[model samples]
Target: MLNKYPLWKNILILVVLAIGFVYALPNVFPDDYAVQITGARSGTEISQQTVDRASEALEEAGIAIKGIDREERSALIRVTSSDDQLEARPIVQQALGEEFLVALNMAESTPEWLQAAGAGPMKLGLDLRGGVHFLLEVDMETAVEQRLEATSSQIKRELREERIRYLGGDLSDGNNIELSFRSEGDRSEAFDIIRDRYDEFLLDESTEGENYLLNLSLSEQEIQQIQDYAIEQNLTTIRNRVNELGVAEPLVQRQGADRIIVELPGVQDTAQAKRVLGATANLEFRLAARQDAPRASTESYPFRDEPERTARLEREVIVTGENVSNANQGFDENGMPQVNITMDGVGGDLMTRATRNAVGRGMAVLFIEFRTEMEQEVVDGQVITREERVEETSIISLATIQSTLGSSFRITGLDSIHEASELALLLRAGALAAPMYFVQERTIGPSLGQQNIDAGFMSVVVGFILVLVFMAVFYRAFGLVANVALTLNLMLLLACMSIISATLTLPGIAGIVLTVGMAVDANVLIFERIREELREGVSPQLAINAGYSRAFVSIVDANITTFLVAIILFAMGSGPVKGFAVTLSIGILTSLFTALVVSRAMVNAIYGGRKVESLSIGGKLANV
Candidate 1:
């Protein structure tokens, strides 16, 4: 049993280790300075000509070229060094102009084939890579207001459908909807209608001086639920937005009750990030009023992109961007930039009913932005500052409906291809449930990230060397075997992380250090068990066999408990805490394998068939 690693077992172990070793090799290669050029607008495809143009521009600038690769979405130009990268970026941007977005990127030094096999280095987290960090505070007040507006629309629809005449409802007293009825009979009728159809609102009857008023407000529980949903939905929406930005690893999670923290790694263009992540924009398809209406800047709404003009749009929304399941930037029949939209079943039904009788009428694509503005007012001889959320709307495009469209449609009137792409991206990312403002913003540069890497690497090396030396001095030959196992365990951990594409943060590094201790601890348990057996005057071979068998259960139990804790931490923790839990979990797993399977296999292979003798651990002892 001491020499139990048969041909098949040995073969399996070798195969796994070899695979791990191969996958972990990419880390040895350094990143190269490169520039990536992607199409800035729809229908602006990059061909060989663009690549050639980029090459010529860089060559003219006297920059050394490493290679040029055409990717599915973008073209990459690899440069010789960082200096060459600095020289090539501006020149390429100039050649491409506004039609293409040129950004600094890092290409791996590993061969392309290895990368093609889906084996690349693990992604580094924001702390390790040093990018953008934003702490966003969700506007709870705006969330409630938005919900109230939605409720108001629903009430109007129901009242009109039931043929109950009433004055339009208004949001009064901060959170309640006050609906005025000229007659008591109509007020009672409306009460029954709302009570039967809507349980979300708590109704109250009151008299506003002389007019009959029905007060409608959401219950406390409903309001709290809506607020919670708003934060959760915004978290999901922000995650989608971050992904659309092509950031490799972004951290978007809820913080406290009404806040979110977003970390974007390896991002250089903060402006673009802000545009895609910060904008609270949506699309609305509405029927345009042909007659010109008087414009009021204070109470009236303005057009989306055109701020100077006003849009007298109907309050009833035909359909919203929320119903859009998919959107892509493309070109129309006349080569105009447009977004091809596909709607969900609900949206499709709404559109069909809306346009059935409205053919030949004008349909306007209105852009809406939920913005917050601050105003100062004097009350009772004292001035107080107030912040107000403005629902800004604009008619981006007004087109005559050619036919009754349902399910799918195209929106035109985008001024540029860039605008089309951006609008499409926003629609596809979905609308935020609540408005948010930046509470804190930070940017970490690549230089700082490199410094963190250097410092972290040095710490690991120092810790590993000290452990390696301690094991060697204490356990001698067996210590050497433990060291070999420790080294392989690390390689396996990294290989596993690369295979899973785990994000390695600073806390993850601490996990690796924790793994080093656990690996050595396992060996120490077995070695101590063997010493106890030897003190009883057992034969060396018997002691060795007993040492492993007796210690195996203990190792499994201890590691199992720790593994369970890691799972809990990972499930509940966020950001760097989760990162640490991930590496620690992987470490516990690999340590068990190395201590029980790997180290034993190596030890038995070396001294199993030879004359039985004492372990080199304690110097001189004879065989039984």
Candidate 2:
């Protein structure tokens, strides 16, 4: 009974190994290359008819497909090969027309039972899975212009509140606001008001004949602050959009002053990622312009639901999407699609102030989308292609103000529930502070990803085999026990990673390799101790007990230190570093369990409750 384990303890060990094996089994089922189709707009949906048409198109094009899996609003066409998938994407897109979005994807072949049990393979990193990478440049100039326009509107409201009169005011030189007054005193008064109220602006007064003009330019500090805010906000927005796309282990970070890098792992096609990440869709709430209002103070935009009908809205914006804190898609009392919006304190206050006295007036919600276009301009006989930012504004909804709106409201008149859902998603993700242009885009093919995976797999296998061979050759019987523990350590490590949904990168594989060596080192120390005890003419069972007991402290000390380092790395690092840290951390735990518990159990079962005159430990104890 010296080295025998309790029945419950043995049962627990067996149960744990069974669970590890069960969870890690999903990794054996490889993903299939597939084409995914979704609606291009909210009004569009992926119907069974659409899937059949796409399937027919693929057959007509002689592209082989394994099967088609249909969902509520999307469908996945699993193809036979990656090459076929690539060729089938465009064909499916053409067959679905512009109403649907077609992109390359991977469909999991995991059985429903495994998935139902919450067991799945580890997610691969971008470098291992071959996804899309985008380098986007922020339109800082346009950001400045938008800031200037908002500032001009604020200044107009401020001057009006102060009872100051001006003939007209307009944005001048793209960075300055010029306001013309009828008298010098009025200009002087306006200058004092602006200088005292707005620290971000530098006010200058000038005269042209009988007209008195006051100019306001943004301060350098304020301009820098705006640019910084724009970059930071765009980073946050892009991250939200990437999450909305359900991309696993995405990287969204700032690179330079006016650039951002977005990496979507498992996103083979850039179309959907680009459309969501780069979209500058925003909302602006403005009061409907009165018929007698000056034309210069109002702008006309076509209705989104009916492009033929136009609505006039005041140029003064009450609030924009930046004020939106949360949004959800829901149906109104009339069963029409609507978006329930929640605003921040500032936006709520602005809405309250704007609508407090205009109860009967109409408020319009403007949907603004900024799109990038290429323009060729001839300058001095050289035709230069330049990127242009095109602004498209439409009135999504116009409703009479029944009461003063507060922190929460609803916007209706959407074309479909899908449209409402998409709008809600975008608004919930927050608006980009500035438009982003794709400066570069690259797709890492699955072939390259497979190569990386093969290389990493080879490394792990080579390291594992070498460790196994060394342990078995040197320690003999005990070394073979350690080898079994090492193999179990790997299975448990992978199980932990898969359970936690950790992304596995190249560094992660390196961590696994390291874990294999460290695992055997524990067994080596115990086996060597056992040899020393046996050389002193001690009984084999007693030596085994003493070896394991004495080595536990050192094993704990070493693994504890390594685990702390992994925690720090995970806390401070991003992307690949985090991936490495996660695997190392999990490996440390699983290695400790295998080295201390599993190996001990195995050693006890092999040599427990039996008298042994000699052991098979190598070196001087080969026949001890």
Write down the RMSD of all candidates, one decimal each. Answer: 6.4, 2.8
Minimal lDDT window, size 10, model 1? 292-301
Taking the tens digit of each residue's C-alpha lDDT, what string does model 1 give over 467-567? 99999998888899999999999999998898987888899999999999999999999988888888888878887888889999999999999999999
Query: lDDT score of model 2?
Result: 0.87
Q: How well is each residue in 1-624 modelled by candidate 2, as lDDT tens digits?
A: 888899899999999999999899899888888998987764556788899999999999999889889987778999988789889988988888888888878888989999999999989999888899889888898888888887788888888988999988888985789999999888988988888888788888888889999988887888899999999998998888788888778899999799999888888756566556767677789999999999988899999878999988998999998899999999989899999999999999989989998899999988888877888989999999998778888998898898999989998878788788878888889988877777788888776787899999999999888888888898888788889999999999988898988999888889888888888888888888888888887877788888899989998998899999999999999999999899998998998899989988987787787776677778775233
* Model 1, TM vs. native: 0.76
Model 1 ranges off by over 4 Å: 1-4, 33-105, 137-145, 166-188, 195-229, 243-249, 254-258, 287-314, 323-429, 437-440, 531-539, 610-615
TM-score of 2: 0.93
Worst window of 10 by summed lDDT in candidate 2: 615-624
Global lDDT of each model? 0.82, 0.87
Candidate 1: pairs in clash: 302-393, 303-393, 303-394, 304-394
Off by over 4 Å in 2: 374-388, 610-613, 620-624
